[model samples]
Target: MPKNVKPVYYGDYLQLDKLLDSQQPHSKQYGPEAHDEMLFIIVHQVYELWFKQVLHELRAIYKEFCAEQLDDRALQLVAHRLRRVLTIQDLMNDQVGVIETMTPQEFLEFRDYLVPASGFQSIQFKELEIILGLTRDTRIAFDQQSFYNRLSEEHRVYLEELETHPSLFDCVDQWLARMPFLQFDDFSFWDVYQQAVQNSLDRDEEIIRQNAADDGQLETELASLQVNRDNFSALFDNERYKSLQEDNRVRLSQRAMLSALFITQYREEPAFHLAHQVITSLAEMDEKLTIWRYKHAMMVQRMLGTKIGTGGSSGHDYLRRTTEQNRVFKDFFAMATYLLPKSALPELPSAVRQALGFYFRHDD
Candidate 1:
């Protein structure tokens, strides 16, 4: 029963050496395929490894909720892992910059060698998406890799545990019963979460209303607070603003639980696609989620123009159709659009374009 009694290895680098040596180029185009290309592949592979860790954290968080224990450790784990995932995504986005520095011609030299291989086919990414409640798409169904097949099994076990449990939303309902605005089930998870946050809004608004009645300094301070945030009355009420966003996941989890879809084999279901509200709200963060497939499509339009994806899917043209994804989150966007300055709302979707795409001058 001794603690920390595991065996140790001296500067052996056994697994490290094996992993480092695994990258192989498909062609002799040293500049494109291997030179900078090796670095690109390494970045993606390492990110996948980090994603693996993030998924483990998510699984742990989901388990804690199922156990009816929304304790500090579970909260810390969720925040820590979400931060890691964000960090990973940030790095992934930054890598686009690095890859952009490579001239299209330089990439083209090795692009042909990539042949049937593409990053979209990453299984670890698919697993991460699934764990985060993304079980609706057939994008993960491209069955070719034996390695990915194995990882998916582990994914199922973790998801199975969540499916059988009370889920985070259920726990939220148990935690905040009798809330007038926050109705459960029939109201929808998004509505429930929206109500929970609105309760805070309601409280803040009440504080304002009361202060005006009293003509008091504290109420005046509350009313004059600055308001600027991704969501809600951003009136900088320091303590209250932080508090509102802080417990958001509890709301988000409740949302996830309320709208949880069942992922099965045929018309399969899993609660992973999130309760839909997350996606809708995510639009405030980036409307591109709904249109990421469109952006991806645009990249195809840029790179290969209309060429097919390495996976043999319908390619960029097909991607345009999916730009309208996120069934549950659609409402989130609809809610956000209501807050827009009206004139700004119509042009919102095309406001930003991803500079990176698939080409260079035929001369280069």
Candidate 2:
């Protein structure tokens, strides 16, 4: 590391003056200052600071995934950075509790002074969602109409341009789809796995027939089993999987989903170790973000009840919908539906096992 020409002072280096002076509450501009308004401003400022750090890490991860080749070292770095983002998300979720301490009556004291400004105006947070693959078409109706409209013209244009690029979700899908381990010369792994899945389902049906207390119970269980059968069958059928995508039942492409499934199933293999870690981290990241949204929605409900937001959203209703609908990497969680127990999984050939070594081989 290069030595500084002069010693760096804490306040000056960190620019505490600008940071400390930035939280000027609008409540003060009104009749008398509201005590809780200060807490509101400081909490949100700290959240934006954390959002900046998360974006920094995510952009680096995105660049790594964009490369034509992602080595184990690069994948390891990506996983590490994602862990940091998850930690920040955990903090953000907890931060909701801090703001919730301000009672609804207390919040009402300064809420009117902040009309026409909402969390919808948070540009960084919107960028975070877009980069993670939330599109205008994917948002709720209210969000599609007003999310960007609420932003300043410059910010709206900037985000609209950002929407034109391939997001991290897109990059990861391409990378996973390019995996060559799906087929090995004449050995069709999926063909073999399909048979195993069939056997597992057959056994499940037999057990249900034997144990179901009534014919109605048996019929319901069998119907559900058929749905699982159909879902598993779609994994190998391109057209069916495409239909699933059209229905928004799954976001990852069929090949990418299969590749992710393969890595997760054989994660203990030498080469798949890091790959599995990457997939797991991405799934956990999605889970954490969803948790944050739910907590934030609950906090909004506690603070405002059925009232409209300062930014003109349905307040808690809008946030709740986003919590359920806005998801990337949900396919990772859904992959569990098709997974077989270790005992049920068909063993890979010795040749196939060797191919999954520390050195990855993409055979033509």
Candidate 3:
């Protein structure tokens, strides 16, 4: 390390002069400045700053996953970084409350002054979505064009190029598909798992049949059970799984889905603990993001009622749709459906147990 260096001033080091000067309210540009506009601008600027930090963490995590192999230490680091992102998401969600402090009437004072500039033009937020794997095909129909149409040519081209790269979700799917635990000699883990699943489904069917009082009730119960049966059946059948994928019912590949399911079911195993944490963190991140979207939609409704967004979106209605559709980690959430109880899980063979455990042996 260098012993001597130029003295660092706080304002210059943090660039407070430029940062503090950046928030110029549109309302002020015209006439009387709306009081609440400052709060709105500052809150959104803070959000962009946080988005930059999240992208920093996500890029590092993506590099780790891009490696040919992720050792336990690398996996631990990935999980740690993901946890940090989750913490930031919690803060971002809570900050929505700060903006909510401004009443709808207050928002209306400056809202028209900033015509055609909506949250839809938030390029950093769009970058975050693209990096996390919300491709154009997966986005809500209006969103597929709305944001693109609103962006400048430079920003639009940048995001279009970004779409060509493998997102964090893509990297995760490939990594899970490569998991060595999915195979061991001629032993097939899924065969045992499928049998256990069948038994559980059978037990459920029996219970439903016994509980149904009349023919109409029995038919309805059976129809619901059939849907569950078909979902489970698709897990073990490649063609059926592919059909589901084609219909967009699932996104992760068959091998990756199975590997994720295995890790989730036997998360207590020493080998799977870190992987489990990664999946859990991703699911929580997805949930937090959804909560943020929902909150934003509610806020929009409170402010604009049924009005169209300044950027030409259907406003609250469009945002509400995105809450349901613009998800990158839904596969992780859906994986829970395929998990069997620990009690129902087959006891691992001795060799498999040794392979999964972190034990040391020595000659007496």
Query: TM-scores, in order shown?
Result: 0.49, 0.97, 0.95
Q: Evaluated with TM-score, which candidate comes out highest?
A: 2
Judged by TM-score relative to the true structure, which candidate is superior, 1 or 3? 3
Q: Where does the lowest 10-residue lDDT sum fall in candidate 2?
A: 355-364
**Tens-place lDDT digits, model 3, residues 245-296:** 8988899999999989988998987777888999999889989999999999
Candidate 1, run of 10 with poorest lDDT: 353-362
After superposing all C-alphas onto the true structure, candidate 1 shows an RMSD in angstroms of: 17.9
lDDT of 1 by residue, 105-160 (tens): 55565676776676555666555444444324323234222224334466656644
Question: What is the alpha-carbon RMSD of candidate 3 to the true structure?
Answer: 3.1
Clashing pairs in 2: none
lDDT of each: 0.43, 0.90, 0.89
Error of 1 at 185 (Å): 19
- Candidate 1, 248: how far from true, in Å? 23
Q: Per-candidate RMSD vs. true structure?
A: 17.9, 1.8, 3.1
Better of 1 and 3 by lDDT: 3
lDDT of 1 at 43: 60
